[model samples]
Target chain A: MSLSSTNSFEKSPVEKSDKGTPDHGECLKVLSLVLDQEATDEEQAYFKQHIENCMPYYEIYNVDKAIKSMIKDRCLNQKTPSDLVESIKSKIYQQAD
Target chain B: MSDNKRQSYSQREKEKTFEQEFLPHIDSMYNFAYRLTFDEDDAKDLVQDTYLKAYRFIESFEKGTNAKAWLFRILKNSFINDFRKKSKQPAKVDYQEVETFYNSEDVDKSITTDLRIETVQDMIGDEISNALNSLDVDFRTVIILCDLEGFKYDEMAKILDIPIGTVRSRLHRARNLLKERLKEYAQKMGYKN
Candidate 1:
């Protein structure tokens, strides 16, 4: 598929939904807040209801969820080298002395 | 106690506080540095420089504030001012280049020929990390700070020295770019269009 084709699908979920669905942008915002665990109880409930009833909202929610899970699983999994801590401690202490 | 001895004692106290307050964030600092530089040696140097600067400016750092955020701010500044300037590697493609290429008409033909979405589907950690690293530094930094380090939007704005609105927009763009890079893999994982 063409790059433009791929990108067309990748447009901001807030911006891409049908024009008649005015609440799509609000849904997208609430979805983001939900993902970040920053949504209020009322907002979360609204989001849950929207996702259940709206196909576009469901699709956006699922895609965003998968992307977030992959990033959390793969990108943030690196263990900081053990010695690095001691090395920094020693180096900083040396400079202090 | 004598004035000279008192001064030394206060210095030691400050040093101890520095160690206690800031040292705990070494792992985080190192991880941030590693993600930014993508090189062990460079990450080490950057963390070391950050600590040194933190120590030097210890007097100015208010006690009991968000030490982690303060340290992160320092680390970020050093990365921009020092590490980027001294990097031995050739200059990276800036956001302008990436934007221009993606927006250009040739993108359609070039993507079909050069895109390797299938290979990325089977890939795991390093593959994903590479995709993130491939993003322009600005975009990559936001992901590292927000997704990886879990910085709040306002915290990120403070650390990156940008407005909160800028932070939101940048984070939005960063996530979009990352999603674009990993879209094939997401599709394989049953992500719907």
Candidate 2:
């Protein structure tokens, strides 16, 4: 397998004909909404149940959640410059004076 | 800003609100600016300008409302009008064009990189940061607002001046794009399934 190789998510439910089940795209959308806390109660319930039964959805959910946390953790490290705060405060004071 | 429903604040109350409400979000504002401009000096100036505008428009701000979201809206507007206009950043595609392209069906098929969770967890360095920075500014903004700042969908819609549906769709697209970027980095690090 080439390192640069790219392929669709393995074992995608979209590739199969699981009757009455949501496809990969719908599952991904619900998963995103649920993780972001934007999902309604029904969507959340749907995701919970879907992930339990669908292995691909479960895997995708874990990976998606991990990526979001990693972004939050990595991006939070860049401390704002120390002087910037003082500078802003001083400017506000000067403007008021 | 010219709406007639602006709040009236005494000078003391204005300062109080600024200190108690707005100033607490300085780090977040600075981080947002830094992410947008991707330059330290530009980020400082942008943050300062945003604060200045926020203070000037302090009368429009309710005393006990979502101060962070209000400040973010101001900062985003300032970045668009001031920084994005003059900055020599590459790939300055029109927002409409970018949105249309992202909305296309082909994008999903084209970026089906099988990035593993372990490989993503292994990126402890600047890999994640670089991947984030590589995204289009619009996409980067959504991730920072949603993932980093923890803004809700409605709040994000207000800050971005878009419908809530747009915010949700854009954020969804942004995350997928971000995953694609991370997949590229994983490949670089010799991750294979």
Top lDDT prediction, candidate number: 2
Location of the lowest summed lDDT over 10 successive residues in candidate 2 chain A: A1-10
lDDT of 2 by residue, A5-50 (tens): 1122223333342477655555665676788987778667767877
User: lDDT (0-100) at residue B66 of candidate 2?
Assistant: 94
Q: Under CAPRI classification, how is model 2 graded?
A: acceptable
Candidate 2, residues B1-193, lDDT tens digits: the string is 4542689898899988988899899999988899888889999999999999999899888767799999999999888888877975554434453244233353344235477778888887598898888889987898999999999988998898887656766776677778878887787778884
Ten consecutive residues with minimal summed lDDT in candidate 2 chain B? B97-106
Model 1: runs farther than 4 Å from truth? A1-22, A77-83, B1-9, B88-123, B184-193
Candidate 1 positional error at A32, Å: 2.0
Regions of candidate 2 where Cα sits further than 4 Å from its true position: A1-19, B88-113
Question: How do the residues A1-97 of candidate 1 rate in per-residue lDDT, one tens digit apiece?
Answer: 1122323423444443435453554565566668766677877877786678776556555655655666667886556677776776787778767
lDDT of 1 by residue, B1-193 (tens): 0111222227776777777888888888888898888888888888888988887777657666678988999999899888887865444434343233233343232223222334344458875787788888888888888777788877888898776545654665566667677765556666452
Worst 10 residues of 1 chain B by lDDT: B1-10
* Best candidate, TM-score: 2
lDDT of candidate 1 at residue B46, scale 0 to 100: 89
Go through the candidates in order and give each one's DockQ: 0.23, 0.29
Task: Point out the worst 10-residue segment of candidate 1 chain A by lDDT.
Answer: A1-10
